[model samples]
Target chain A: MTNPTAAMLVIGDEILSGRTRDANMHFLAGELVRHGIDLNEVRIVSDDRDAIVTAVRALSEAFDHVFTSGGIGPTHDDITADSIAAAFGAPIDVRDDARALLEAHYARTGMELNAARLRMARIPDGAALIDNPVSTAPGFTLGNVHVMAGVPAVFQAMLASVLPTLTGGSPLLSQSLRVFRAEGDMAAQLAALADRYADLSIGCYPFHKDGVFGANVVVRGADGGRIDAAMSDLARDLGL
Target chain B: MTNPTAAMLVIGDEILSGRTRDANMHFLAGELVRHGIDLNEVRIVSDDRDAIVTAVRALSEAFDHVFTSGGIGPTHDDITADSIAAAFGAPIDVRDDARALLEAHYARTGMELNAARLRMARIPDGAALIDNPVSTAPGFTLGNVHVMAGVPAVFQAMLASVLPTLTGGSPLLSQSLRVFRAEGDMAAQLAALADRYADLSIGCYPFHKDGVFGANVVVRGADGGRIDAAMSDLARDLGL
Candidate 1:
């Protein structure tokens, strides 16, 4: 009756240092909800090993599935694979299948398979490789954690492979209507509407743009009919 | 000396449901770094009381300071003030000072402070009120967590008031340059650069855009002189 829950662990210093915004979290959140997996929480940590290990253990235990992005590349800061191995107490080595993929990729590109490049082939023991069609470096699923690259294109491709394997429930549907009224003005009636549609999650997000103050009322649920009913009622009552 | 470490707990179902992207984390991360605080972790959870309380307790214990956003509004979904109170086991009621602020603002604006608006005056015991210059509803500081508004304008305004009060260390400095090179080709030199400048955090972030595969190599440290020296050495060595 309930969807499986998931948490995302984004490992990177660039994000925490304010060099980049975490686009992966947003992308994964939208895709997970569409796949019928309820995203319960998301944690962004630096590239420190202890931080990674601790967060992995905590979120993995709390949710049915865990998706991690970042720190899985070839740079010196890339330590997600080793950290995931440490988190699960799994022995990690350069797996033959992963190495084969990397080796074939380098050969095709006329690049050397040096020791630094070989780091991409490291996978924790007993983990399954999540295919990366965008890049040859494979993301792996160890225990309940799916570790993928930080790069947006590669991460999206890896998720396309991993999401189908997981069990999901009915996809959540949402409908929204924007009204030119202050949130304070709409709070009471909105609360009443929320009470009437007990099955739906009614959320009012206020916005102030171009000297106009208004709110966007959104209703979400597993049933599309309930979402439509609530949204229509909201529109009729709010006169928008 | 280690700078004060901080974490952010974003409370909203909108972010987790993919309905909204958390712009506040990015904004806060940049501001905190400028203020010399190391933002080590960020967690985004839905607008659930138990989830908020548990995250508040965990992050509050782990970091020196915690900044929370969202769920502090007039609507029924705005449960942050009560949740923070529950997290600290503090009794919550309509604090007189908060009520006065709302009362005065409503009177001046010719709007009545109705029951829903009065909900904004509820504050936990012993929590200091955080001034909301844009809106009269004040955010509060209970324990180490600074509970603030979710709206970006109001959140930024509240932070301007809150930041000057906290003690800050030397600001973190960073410098970066873009080079049209694949991550695989640059991994070795980047690792060598990172090792040479152990005092700084040297990170190479890869990107694929407009049919160009390149990376931005960034160097960060508290010491401006050290960062400059490291960046110069990187430029000379990598021939960027």
Candidate 2:
């Protein structure tokens, strides 16, 4: 069977506006790689409903799994769940399980479970709830889309709980060779190496230091031994 | 006049595979914002030719400007220029200007400008070259799309030169207030504040610490004086 593929939809206006740098995409990418699930694309959209709906539907159909982070909070702008549910043609309502979890959480802290706070209880029909360790507002999985909180801690916790349930491919393997040459100079040789090993992904990342140009060529594939072998061939071909 | 909007297309398989954490998107987003340009969307796609062609065509039509990073190297996988040219129905050939630049760079460094290196000189007809401070291989601009180096430093320098050539909208003004309260508890008040200032983008970013929930409320607008007024009213309403 082919490798299981995934996509991430980071929903936040703050991220798109340059107000907040996203840390979730990297975290989830690494986690998915470790589980042998390849994350092929990432789309970061504003908190607009149409944008959310369009992205969710498109990404859900394109990949084996889709994980969305953000816009699940109690605020009026937090519309991810509703949009996602609508995209799946699944009606949304306050589920009893989610409500009980929120009620118990607020009761323990002696806080008001007001209308705004209860907004977190909305979930798509026929979805399995993913528990948040840091907070009581539960994330849920509808079809292949796993919805999580925007806050990093809660999102991470929910993702950790959800990932174990999904089927993963062979974990990706990688090897790196740091070259003290400019990427442009080594581009052809590197390209040849990439072509030689069609299964491996060879990336030439350039870094500059005080007028000196350098690059790190990372060769990645599903097999650790094959990746290392390909890296050796690249180093010899590039004279690195 | 409407704000000059730009979107970034990051073309690379490495980024999608979780092999590399992207640094270019964040850099471009901040730089574009500082230059009074709005970055509407960013799409990270693999080295597939059709994907690049489709995205380039769509983004070039939608935004005032499109900045693409990665996939301009000498490798077989570096197909950005060819794909972009296909999108514009333009011929891709090795231009005299780009070849001369590469020759001069190789001459200065005492390196051979081999056939592989000469591949770097391929540019779409009618494209103007953008200077690369960190490397000799040049990036270029075709219409509204500015193809940039994937290397962060080189990309930043090329972008610097490009920004001075374009017209911008009114600079985006912003003010932030860090408050100690959960997002759910602060939702009603923040919503009212947002409703009062319809022109402003009021974002509430929540943070948790020591079993406490806190949020930073950022107010953004095109007008400096109006942003300040809105922020002041927000602080007064929140009593912070």
Each model's TM-score for chain A is: 0.97, 0.97
Tell me the interface RMSD of model 1, in angstroms: 1.0
Chain B TM-scores across candidates? 0.98, 0.97
Q: Which segments of candidate 1 are over 4 A away from where they belong?
A: none
Q: Give one digit per residue, the lDDT tens place, for model 1 in A170-205.
A: 898998888888788889989999899988899988
Q: Which candidate is the best by lDDT?
A: 1
What would the per-residue lDDT of candidate 2 be over residues B1-240, giving only the tens digit for each residue? 668888889887777766677888888877777788888777788778887898899789978999999878765667888888999999999999999999998999888888767878999999999988767689999999999878777788888878899898877778898888888888998899889888888888888977878888888878888888888887788777
**In candidate 1, residue A44 scores what lDDT?**
95
Instruction: Report the poorest 10 consecutive residues by lDDT, candidate 1 chain A.
Output: A231-240
Instruction: Please state the CAPRI-style docking class of candidate 2.
Output: medium
Q: After superposition, how far is residue A24 of candidate 1 from its true place, in Å?
A: 1.1
